[model samples]
Target: MDPGLLYDLSMNDYLNFLCVSGYNQTLLKAFSGAHYRCPDIINIMDFNYPTMTIPKLYGSVSLTRRVKNVGSPGTYRASLRVSAGLSISVKPNVLKFDKIGEEKSYKLTVEVTSPGDDEAFGGITWSDGKHYVRSPIVVGGVRGVFHVLDKTQFIDLGKLHQQLNLEVRRKRRSKALSQIAFVGVLCQGGTVDCMK
Candidate 1:
């Protein structure tokens, strides 16, 4: 807090001190100077879906791209790419931007082949023959058999047996049979019924 200490502090040090002192508003205003402004060449959407469960075959999502600065005012191109284990096709994979602030959207179709639950990740890259940037893309899907287990740990079966009724036990057995039938259908490609 000494007055002489301020003279030795650099611009970054001053901003860091302001930020650590909880003067976030004042820190942002100080950093938003004209000299801090720079041209943004390209901007793309970031995929942040924590978990997306999709069925087999096809799942689609729309991706958006925008040209923040069209330097020479010519054609700029962008393309989409996906990770392995997933077949992806982008409608209008190649995008053209004529001017700055021009935005375009593309449809991304993903074909899930494997039956196991998995996640896919990739990115889209845009370039103007001089500068380029890649934005991340993520997709998650579940195929084949899926299971949902109950929290039976809290219910002590030994203690429940004394108070359990036939109806309650039958209902639990019926639920288990239905799950088994679903798994059989997915794995063997045939309908199964434990009740029958």
Candidate 2:
């Protein structure tokens, strides 16, 4: 490492650095608690369970979130929203804080009506009707009723598969020939179970 390449920052300057790049996984660990960047706002502390996975989702699940309003004299409304195949209910959703560091525990009841669902999305939000503070959520179960994951930027397997199928159709193969050969090849490759 070159000495000249490294620059040191004061505590205040380091905090500002965190404000800009705190979401980065590496920086979040290096700086410890990046949650202090905005002190005059509601803080969702110990948000360790942002994403959860269940092998087989059946019936419903109960979750609790402890929240504290670090800002002085603040009042906000908390709510829970979920996608289809699931629902969530929050207890004592409204919050009123006259003093700083007013802590409250919110009970969340998550119901998964359909066990066969592959995935669903939801979130918890605290809003003052001016600014919306949100926490994202993702839940997953078994894969594939379909051939692909929702296409992503880094790897467009789904789109590529569609394109190749289009090309094959243009080639004019007979009904006896294989259709969507890529899917068959992928299944044979053993990464995904074709039997499922």
Candidate 3:
């Protein structure tokens, strides 16, 4: 190798290394909590079931490094550690129903827990009429029916089948009942389910 060219190459490598590891290298750091929204919860109910929305937040830290003579300059990166303070939590993960039915308007309550305060409001109503599982429902005057599907789950496949069964009977009054599998209510939880 040529002496002059080798000296120049070594000098370049040394300068590059010094530039990256020097105490004067600039670094910027920031810690932030990114805004996050809660997931939506919807379920079928013989009557409307009281529901709640829980909000969440994701916290992260960002860092940037600056180098004077690097080929591609410096870079920036951000990360979040999984910890109690890093994530926001909601109270009462499941909302309780005070009074819910398709017959009458029901109220839903929401409780928030995190860095902020808790709030409670009344008069939140849900209607099965608005969302029909099948067929376009006519607006106004036609009262919607609230059929109980499950006493524990409030909404279940068996209950939906029952509602459809009733609709079929209403449509075909004189027709013989179809060969539908009958589903009986199970005594698994009963009142003990509410203690959870």
List per-prediction Cα lDDT, in the order shown.
0.42, 0.52, 0.26
* TM-score top scorer: 2
Q: Residue-wise lDDT of candidate 1 within 1-196, one digit each (tens)?
A: 2111001223544444445545556445767442322222211221222122232322333433222443544443556576666655666656565655454555555554454447666666656565564555565543433433233421233234434445456667554433322221221222222212
- lDDT, residue 3, model 2: 15
The segments of candidate 3 whose C-alpha lies over 4 angstroms from its true place after superposition are 1-154, 173-183, 190-196
Which lDDT tens digits does candidate 3 get at residues 1-196?
A: 2111000122323333333443122321111122222222212111111222222211211111111211212221112122222232222222222222112121222212222222212222111222211111111111112233344454455566687788888788544554353323333443335323
Residue range 1-196, candidate 2, lDDT tens digits: 2111111233544444455544554565466644444333322322324333333334555555555555545666877777777777777787676765566666666666554436777887876665465656566742222233322421455457567667767887764342443321233323444333
| Winner by lDDT between candidate 2 and candidate 1 | 2
TM of each candidate vs. truth: 0.40, 0.44, 0.15
TM-score: the better of candidates 1 and 3: 1
What count of clashes does model 2 give? 0
Q: List the residue pairs that clash in candidate 1.
A: none
Listed per model in order, the count of residue pairs whose N, CA or C atoms clash below 3 Å is 0, 0, 2
- Compute the lDDT for candidate 1: 0.42
